[model samples]
Target: MREPYARYLQLLGFDQTPHGVEGLRQLVRRHVIRVPFENISKLLLIRRERRGRPTTLNEYLDGLERHDLGGTCYTSNPFFAELLRELGYDADLLGCDMTRVNVHTAMRVRVDGSAYHVDVGYGGPFYEPLLLTDSPHEMRQGPYRYVLDRARDGRLAMNVFTGEERVHGYLVNEIPREREFFTSIILDSFRPAATFMTQLCVFRYFEDHAVQLQNNVAVHYRAGESGETRISSMKEIREIFENQLRLPRCPVEKAIKTLEQLTGQDFFAMGEGDLYV
Candidate 1:
């Protein structure tokens, strides 16, 4: 294996290279727990460089090693697909639809004799791959439930439910896409109206629980219960990021300061609402 790739495996806590369906599951599980879904690095890059773009594979690996930073779908999913390919898995980078067309990215890997939807960047509680089949696959982690089913249009839909209420979802397109296909869309995400550019959001998922922070609100979901707390200050935000999410303190602080300067408001005073990831 290449040196950086070897280091990446070490960061994921793997002693030997993984293969097959069970190995794929273990890889996915370890990945999502170790890396997080956060926009802090993105925000910092955009602020310093005055532009938006996708992170290169080496840059992504470096960020994880240096700052405990993982990116949004645009960065995390594509690089992860590349890593899977390097490990000899038949992985394809696929596009998906949220409120807009081809706005989100995911992966489809053919492991063993079956195909599976593997998403480690969605900032959700997906600890393993969701098998792609005609039957709906349901998974419950903490207080949230996820169902992956085929829609009438032949597209796969992943729906998230919290206490019988369908809160969020996306439709996956099976066609594979080249990296250049998402360049413009990724650039557009740095626009003033985009969600991440407007607010501060970070998510970390574990096997049994998940933690999320959006602006002034922090929410956590544990075994059978979940709760939300309103953050009152930047100090509180720093505590949550450093202590709970295990993110580096310098980048978190810099991102918070940049967000306040960009939006002209106290970062911790904004109201929390549903963020379309």
Candidate 2:
């Protein structure tokens, strides 16, 4: 188990042995860019289970290769956690509901003593995680930012941002007892959410920025900038296969067709013209 996990670390550029806080930060920056935050495979897993089946790590890895991506916070954090354990770093996945209406999921991780509000899988710009500290602090990266504070009732309130507008992305439960209840929530995430279902999207953190391929658009986050680029359109969605994301045209076509077939709607049926324009 350690060998396979260690291999992933090598792939993620950890020094086989990271020294301390600086090393941990580099690891965070490294994997966010290396492993993709994706949902195609997660959606596939949900579908398979609905039909009374299961998926394996090999199946997931294959999906990672086929989709040209990995996963959102759910996928990226754990993948990062696994590799950290392999590299002997103390890490854990912090599950969050984004405490908002417009989005589905988000997570932050503490690789050593510090925290990072990682949402590379959320299909938009991401907020840097909060480093472990006593005082209040806020950080902004591209289109997203977060302020960390202890609520009166003793919760870690993350005041999230998308420019001047701000909302609660999530309330980090500071009660150690509460965090313990979700001991297995990590692997359980892949099993599917039985109560709610919706279209999935993600953003994988990269070295310089982050990459997001959702519904039909493939984009990359440019640092110090609030907007992202539509590298290819659903029209050029095939490029996700031929280009960087490595999604195969055939299966991707099948996935796209399934969505249209099931929902009775095309991507742009909402009346927006060329999304890239």
Candidate 3:
């Protein structure tokens, strides 16, 4: 495992031995703070997204391996556990069902008798792991601050303060690692009426902040200042492949054409888009 994850740890600036919860926290913080999540490596996989056959974790990793783009929470959380093991931290890879169409994978670490959710993956949900406690907290970083309040209803509610103001945003539930996790997320995603109200989003939570990417928008929220940047375009999604994410010449045209065909709209038109990212 050490040999396999050596390159990744080095890439994430965790090439040293990182023991205990603080170490794990630092490791995750480094990953999310550095890596920018993107999907342009579809060309490297050369496998098109087919109906009922979304790209799995293995495929995404393979795509990243081929293109040098790497992965976000979906692949990185499990990889984080591998590194923690090398550092002698008790960690495990757990799968949580967040929605019907999305099954999120994360790392659970127990260090110094306290458990923390270390997920540097899942770009739209969290950025680092959260201490599983019922509390209101703010994660503050330079020029960004994101807030989370555990609702009385036991729902993990959050809002991305986009500098200008607050907006109705993400709703998260911390599902346990269960055998039915995969199926549950699928059931939630495809239910008769889904209410996520965002694009196909993923998240990573830190102690006080979370980082997420919804479609082409990248949001960094902690506790003080916040940064929201338009990282992609619904109209120019094809260009995103060619520019920001850097996809192959083939997949760019293919994804755009597929999106266009599905929505009966121009692929480069931002005015017309779907909730799914």
Candidate 4:
């Protein structure tokens, strides 16, 4: 394996390169548990550089090593697909639609003659690959239940439900997308009107539960129950990042400061609804 890819595997806690379906499952599970899905790094970069772009493999790995940083879908999924290809899996970058067209990125990997939907970047707990087939595939993590099924238009729909309510969803386009296709969308995300630029949101998944921070509110979900706590200050936010997520202190402080400067409001005082598109 190449040096960077080797380091990626090491960070994911793998002793060797994984192979086949079970290997793919292990990779996906380990990745979501270890690497979070957050836009804090993006916020810092946009403040420093005055522009937003996806991270290169080296930059992504470096951020993880230095700051415990993981990125949004644009950075996480494409780089993960690249790693899968480096490991000799037939993985393709796929586009997803929420409120807009091709606004999200995911992966489709063919492992031992079966195609599986693998996404580590949705800021949700996707603990395993969802097999792409005519039949619906379902899994539950914490208080949320995820269902992947074919839509009437032949596209796959990934839906997240809490109890009887469908809270989140996206339509997946099976057509293979080149990396360049998402450059414009990724850049657009840094715009002032974009959701991530306007509010604070972060997610971290564990084996039994997941933690989500949207603006001033933090929700901890596990199995049949969830608890909510209101954050009153940036210091509280930093505590959550350090204590719950185990992120490094320097980048967390830098990211929070940049967020306040960019949005012109206290990070914890902002309103909610940043978690969904």
Q: Pick the candidate with the highest lDDT.
A: 4
RMSD to the true structure for each prediction, in A, is: 1.7, 5.7, 6.4, 1.7
TM, every model: 0.94, 0.67, 0.58, 0.94
Alpha carbon deviation, residue 181, candidate 3 (Å): 3.8
Q: Cα deviation of 236 in candidate 4 (Å)?
A: 1.8
Score each candidate by Cα lDDT: 0.83, 0.49, 0.49, 0.84
What digit string (tens of lDDT, one per residue) describes model 2 on residues 1-277? 3656655556656554775666666665665565555545545544455432233344544555444546544445545555555556655545543433212333445554566544444443333444646447766566567666676776556666767777445655322222233435434544323211223354555446655555655455565664433433454766654555544532555444444444556754422222111
Displacement of residue 65 (Cα, Å) in model 1 is 1.1
For model 4, how does the per-residue alpha-carbon lDDT over 133-226 read when each residue is reduced to its tens digit?
6459777766678888887898889888878898888999888998889989988999987988877678889888888878778888887578
Error of 4 at 65 (Å): 1.0
Candidate 3: segments with Cα more than 4 A from true spot: 39-59, 68-74, 78-87, 92-107, 124-128, 132-135, 140-145, 153-180, 183-254, 272-277
What would the per-residue lDDT of candidate 3 be over residues 1-277, giving only the tens digit for each residue?
Answer: 4465566666666546666666766776776654544433322222243322134544544444454354543445555565677778877767643333235566667778776655565454354567767345565444434566655676555444546465333445444443234444533433323322112233334456655544455456666546755644544544433443333332434434443444455533433223233
